[model samples]
Target: MSMFDNISVVKKANVYFDGKCVSHTVQFPDGTRKSVGVILPSTLTFNTGAPEIMEGVAGSCRVRLAGETEWKTYHAGESFDVPANSSFDIEVMGDPYHYVCHFG
Candidate 1:
């Protein structure tokens, strides 16, 4: 039950947020899709239709979960969970934020 046991990569993706972010969609053997992206320095809010695990692969950012008053910072090898049908804010403080979003 290890991660990356049967993965497929789709190398190219459309630039999102007017070029502030770019992501490649990848798939797992179980048919789950993940978006691996690099986000430029900016504050952005995203809505999740399903539960998601956002993993930080490089750089850092501060995130405020929906209905939360405090902001948490995540760096390389860190991850956070976002609830389904909720929104969260991410602030990139002058560095690109690289992440992989796994949906469930």
Candidate 2:
């Protein structure tokens, strides 16, 4: 079995992307903590199921799914998710961003 196989409670962690910040908590199954930050220039896209990716918005950026119609704006204190089997991308409208991610 895994080291965390017996874990039951959820663990929380904080991540900062660009200027945006978010807290993630994972429970049961795999007692892991994930934190992430992301910045995009123009537009960037990724395939789904690649992994669980989180991006924190710093300045001005837009996030949306590939071939989708709408783009959501992300700013400081905002968080976005990259779901499994879903395509997503981010467009940077300002400067380069930074994200602090921790996973265990």
Model 1 lDDT tens row, 13-87: 958778887888889887888988889999888888999999998899999999999999999799999999999
Query: Model 1, which residues run further than 4 Å from truth?
Result: 1-6
Deviation of model 1 at 68, angstroms:
1.0
- What's the distance in Å from true for residue 32, model 2? 2.2
Looking at model 1, residue 65 earns an lDDT score of: 98
Instruction: Report residue 96 deviation for candidate 2 (angstroms).
Output: 1.5
After superposition on all C-alphas, the RMSD of every candidate to the true structure, in Å, is 2.6, 9.2
Model 2, residue 46: distance off in Å is: 1.7
Q: Report the error of model 2 at residue 14, Å.
A: 20
Off by over 4 Å in 2: 1-40, 50-57, 100-104
